[model samples]
Target chain A: MSENRPLILVTNDDGINAPGIRALIEVMNTLGDVMVVAPDSPQSGMGHAITINDTLYCNSINVIKDAPHKEYSCSGTPVDCVKIAVNEILKRKPDLCVSGINHGSNSSINVIYSGTMSAAVEAGTQGIPSIGFSLLDYSLEADFGPSKKFVKAIAQQTLKNGLPKGVVLNVNIPKLNASEINGIKICRQANAHWEEKFDKRTNPVGRDYYWLSGEFVNDDEGEDTDEWALRNGYVSVVPVQFDLTAYRAMDELNSWELK
Target chain B: MSENRPLILVTNDDGINAPGIRALIEVMNTLGDVMVVAPDSPQSGMGHAITINDTLYCNSINVIKDAPHKEYSCSGTPVDCVKIAVNEILKRKPDLCVSGINHGSNSSINVIYSGTMSAAVEAGTQGIPSIGFSLLDYSLEADFGPSKKFVKAIAQQTLKNGLPKGVVLNVNIPKLNASEINGIKICRQANAHWEEKFDKRTNPVGRDYYWLSGEFVNDDEGEDTDEWALRNGYVSVVPVQFDLTAYRAMDELNSWELK
Candidate 1:
């Protein structure tokens, strides 16, 4: 590791201008020399997608004040932003990569649809210690004040003690007053899902259309889950990895007939 | 279970007109009632994205002949298609939702970026037995002839015996002749990744741009991996799930100091 301040790369799924990323940039500014390379537009549910089929355009945007950090807006997904940041922008392998203070929760099943988590996962895949921060609130005016200290602490800790290889942290902060917020809790991703309800309507062209709508349902009653942590007004940090292999079921599945 | 033919929902990430989906549709027609609600345009690498920010349109199109399967071209992501198909199009919950016969392999880390696998995962979340099929080739004219029998067999088996809840199969057929191909192998996702190399170029206006380029690097030497199966010319069947929890690391992570 470098003797100077750690090089921290910051990005988010909620676009570069979102209040969430701005708050994150402010917090990360206190920790190290930061660089912001995020999407030009909101890419919330992009997952781990990269822009392979199209050319990517990135331009340095002057957004932050006094902070020596560089910022760029990229026309790509969150994963694409991370890849471009690591491979194109940064001079060396970053000491850490942090994504989000996402506008919404990516607590459980929502992780699969999250561009924020995917950026962190992309960083992890490239052997960088990373974390994706999110708030339980989906509102544009969601309070992120409670998360500032927690985000700084987590970043400082990760910088002091590096994470395990292939493991990145998924941090979800409960939307609460800084004083009312409970302590941090490291937990597992809860068993949860979206019960989809599409609102069908007739378009101006007389064609039927639909809008995606859903309600999150958390079924896991376990107290040691991210969902539980948020519910109790605590910041939840779940150590997440990219290996989707369900190792426990591998042997059982192997026994099944392939013919 | 119903006594009549099972209601099978077929879709893909490569758009409704892709040859891979056509091959899959052909195989599905032999087994049961197939309803295809695929993206109107290509959605490869869309991952688990849904059209939440925008409106979605699904138009019933007449494409294939003699199949008698109802098909709709959706203006949304792969996951969105599955959601609309389940919530609006299908009168009842489908027995199966099969996505892809994808133009490329969705093995290992590719699953993280696969719109095809996302469709399958979405179905599994809805408690429908699902599978995502892919070929080893990425060619538009990639032959699906050799794998049809195996695809039919697997779909038939899945229909006959339901998959465990929360588990969906990611099946990648080897791009080889039936005679050259070995049998199916139930495997784990390989610890593989793309080593990204951005192709930089200046546009007409002298602005710099990048084209995402990468080569798949398989570091895992495990013989039981999906990468191994594909390399050995065998069809790889990896039972995948939407749960992203790294269960083994939960306790260890919790031991970290929060203060």
Candidate 2:
């Protein structure tokens, strides 16, 4: 409720204690009053999932000692974290909501299965300026040192100039150092898909189980795509929308012979 | 994998035992060689979540005895079911994929948080012609008799015409008797969202917990929307696409002063 500073909400699919979120919190502290409410445990790949069938437990955490911003960890998905923050935790609507600084890339078709982008999109649906950040590295100890400046820059600019209505940004940084990065490029989501290759195993009880895994195939040869931007050593920023309607295909569907 | 019979894949957000999917199964059996792979437990509101962090158990279940179709129940989200079906179970890529005759509506804003539509979208990502169907009624005992004809009609059309690349269908039927209902309407997703209303409860141990619930709010008055079509007693079929890129906002985002 500070008059001088904007109220910024921070969350991520990675748990509150994750290094990626810690890096994000460090950047947001300079911008405004930050309220961090993220999952108590890692919630990667939980795309837009809410805790409807179960109870949620959210409590204050002392992740960083004497941190100016308050942080709460919840036992729910990323979308659940955002909903609870907006509905019950925050005194008023946040000026901006930022998610991720994810441990891995969420470019192209990965967005659909991304918990990071889903958190940002959920905030966007509530009419808040939002963005999701990710690094091409999927390691727990991924270098977030270089990402700080770009993250701060984008967040600062978003706070200064609001995002377009019904749109949120999906930003992906390359796995290179600050000097090697070609800088940010506003790009389109490349047409791609995950070629699923499940790892099947037999348990002690002689029953089979599967661990879901995949190979991301980016067939989109567009020079102006998120895949291209990231592969070419630039941070890719694709403005994402929640409206799923295929407006261009409505006319073709109308021609179907249905009664 | 007979050439004479089109290979159809059926799945739903509701468990394989639900009457809604049972209704869908009855209809699909008459169409092609149907392979039913769905969650063993109810997975409503699970969105596009995939089971990445945990092991998934999928087993053959005899839900409908000698029903002339194979049914495998998986302990995973809707998207996980689709992924497993395509990668581990199916002999070949499905000719078409159909999800749900969900016990509740997935119209308008519900599509984002809907496991039903997510299943269809997951299939669509792999180039399968897919559709998610739902009835306005949420009750477990809700009658699906009226929905059968329309479901068959739409599925048949999809198998014959095939969907546009990267597009799937989200169809919601009004909870009206067959005779009292109007015909199908090709529409766009209505702009709407859920107004969150969390119910806070104290546990016996004096710890606070919250149950996530919301009121569906649809303010979009456009007649070409799925909400409007459903309100007027028609089956609303919105051609939904997996591409979340906000093409219109790319230019505006490019204008941002972020380096």
Candidate 3:
């Protein structure tokens, strides 16, 4: 942005060795000087967690041999990697920060619980223009072909236009081939909730234990929603902000007699 | 609205045995039928994380002496506690959910990383009227004396006047004596972030590690903000929403040439 090749910081929640971050690194390399500091293990549902209770471990890795990028693997949540990168790893604030080309969908209400989006949100809070990309596919071998070009274009657009202050992008690509995919659509987060069903089981000692499993239930059918766009074969791009303030509810709260 | 006493869910990020939750439990007991399912250990900065990768362990615990409320100690994040309560523990969806009389401030940017607020946000997603309470003091012996009446009044008001759809409250009390404290002021989350200063340390074996630490820096001077209210000796109440979508920026994103 300052007439220099933009310093782009890359990271993700699916761990450093995931194919998704590999794809992201390649795309980021084509865009600018790239530096990646990502988690060492998969952290899918980590949300906006930071490593405050425990010590964090970070080590340099040679993931892409001879590639013109510096990458490190940190034993922390996605949000932690971003903090470590900006505060301890990077020489200066990055011009842009991109998180994920995630292994699964992070659309709808999933954004709140997504470590992918949380990394981007963390960067946005620190004045970096940021975006988190996800594909509807959830497998290790999922194809990132269709999403690469779109990811490049979005990153380029963000670099050129700059994002709105306090906003980051949540881009979800539908699980479809390049040709079958309709372009990208700017949309809002569709309202949704997980119908949680804990799979109860007994340990070897006969104590009860549980595994959390949930079915995503979409409650909003609005056409202008991330869920709708992805379902209709479009890569949905939702601008997300970290300011959780519900300004509209302030008046009603103020009306209460608190004296 | 129902003839039966309102079924109230109480939870916090500070573990099941924290004095803050104990204070909250005492207040909620006066207004409704309370059930508490909280983390067995402190989960202060856990955010909205869930227990997905690991098996969850939840066991009923007698937290208070001859207390009428049923309590469970959960080995999970605060968000997990809410899910377990709603989907497994509680007989039905709760009428109201209240999280924390947290030991520290969750005002401004801290809300994004707050386990207390995350518990409340999880309940709001379930269509339950919810509120999170925090005190400006961060101490094991922090006085919740001044906050009890306010906490009761707010929770009572939430039971009486259901919160706006998709919204929950983030209430923070100033650390002052009840007589010295000003009243409550409904406000918005102040624009701010932790100016991160990672206290990097080397382990006994000479490996690099970090303990996350930071100072709360207030960048917003708005009089109608949580920081301002807290600074002025008033308990700040900020209405929080889980919808990460930045609706105002949708128009700008739409103009991007993503094709």
Candidate 4:
């Protein structure tokens, strides 16, 4: 409730103690009063899932020693973190909300299945300026150092200029050093999807089980796409929306014969 | 795979034993050689979540004795069923995929949080023509008789004319009887959201936990919306897509001073 500074709500899908979030927190410390409400455990690929059928547990935590920001860990998905933060944790509406600096890429089609971006979209649904940041690297020791400046720049600019209603940013940083990064490019999500090939195996109990795996396929050759931007060593910023409606197809659907 | 009939994949967010999926199964059986792959447990509100961190169990189950279709119950989210069905269960790609005669409404913004629609979208992502159908009535005993004809018509139409890649239909039916139903309308998703209010309660150990509750708010007055169509006793069909990109906002985002 600082009068001079903006209140920023921070969250991520990689759990409260992930290195990606710590890097995000360090950058947000320079911007405003930050409140982090994240999952107690990693919630990757959870999409926009919420804890409707289950009870939610959210508690204050001090993960970072002497950290300036207030933090809470919740027993829920990334979207649940935002819902609880906005409804139960924060007293007043936050001026901004940012998710991730995620452990891996949320670029292109991954945005549909990303827990990191889902947190951001949830915040955006609640009428807050929100952004989700991700790196192309998937390793736990992935270099988040190069992402700091772009993260700060995007966050600062978002704070300065509010996002339009129903829209949030999905920013994917390429795995390049700060000097090598070719700045930010506002782009469209590339038309892409995972060609899922489930790894099927038999358990010790003689029962079949499946582990979901997939190869990323980007058939979109548009140079003005997130995939293209990331491939060219640029930080791609795609404005994403919660509305699933394909407005362009409405007319085509109307042409169908249905009495 | 018979050349005389189209192959159909039937799934639901509600468990395989739910009356909703059974009704969906009965309807799809009339359309083609149906393969029923649904969650063994109710997965309402699971969104586009996939079981990544956990093992998924799918087994052959005979919920409907001697039913003309092959059925399997999976211990996974609705999206997981689609992945497993396509990758491991089905010998060939399904000609059409239909998800849910869901026990509840997935109209408007609910489409984003719907496991039903997510299942259909997952199918769509895999290049299968798909549709997710729901009735406004959430009761287990809610009559799906009114929706059967419409559902058959829609599925038949989809099988005849394949859906554009990445797009699926999100169909919500009014609770009215088939005779009272006002037919179908191709509509846009209404601009609406859940005004969430968490119900806070203390456990036996005096630890506070919260249950999510929300009021559905539809402020959109557009008559061309799914909400308005459903409210007017019509079956509403909104063409939904997996691409989260806000194409219209790309130009405005491109104008941001990021470099």
| Residue-level lDDT tens digits of model 1 in B1-259 | 2349899999999999999999998899889888999999999889888877899999988995655788999999999999999988888999889999999889999998899999999999888999999998999988899989989988887887788767899999988999999899988999988888999999999999999998889999999999999999899989887777776776666566774
What is the C-alpha lDDT profile of model 4 across A1-259, one tens digit per residue? 4777989999999999899999999999999999999999999989989899889999999887888899999999999999999988898899999999899999988898899999998888889999999998989999899899999989998999888779999999999888999889989889888888888899998988888888989999999999999999999999999888888787777788886
How does model 1 fare in lDDT?
Answer: 0.89
Worst 10 residues of 2 chain B by lDDT: B60-69
Candidate 1: count of backbone clashes, pairs at least 3 residues apart or interchain: 0
**Model 3 vs. true fold: TM:** 0.98
| Candidates 1 and 2 compared by lDDT, better number | 2
Candidate 3 — which pairs collide? none
The local distance difference test score of each candidate is 0.89, 0.93, 0.92, 0.90
What order do you get sorting by lDDT, best first?
2, 3, 4, 1
RMSD in Å for all candidates: 1.7, 0.9, 1.6, 1.1
TM-score of each: 0.97, 0.99, 0.98, 0.98
Query: Local error of candidate 4 at B213, Å?
Result: 0.7
Off by over 4 Å in 1: A1-3, B1-3
- The list of candidate 4 runs beyond 4 A from truth reads none
Best by lDDT: 2
Q: Give the Cα error of residue A81 in candidate 1, in Å.
A: 0.2
Query: Cα deviation in Å at residue A2, candidate 1?
Result: 7.8
What is the C-alpha local distance difference test score of candidate 2?
Answer: 0.93
lDDT of 2 at B58: 97
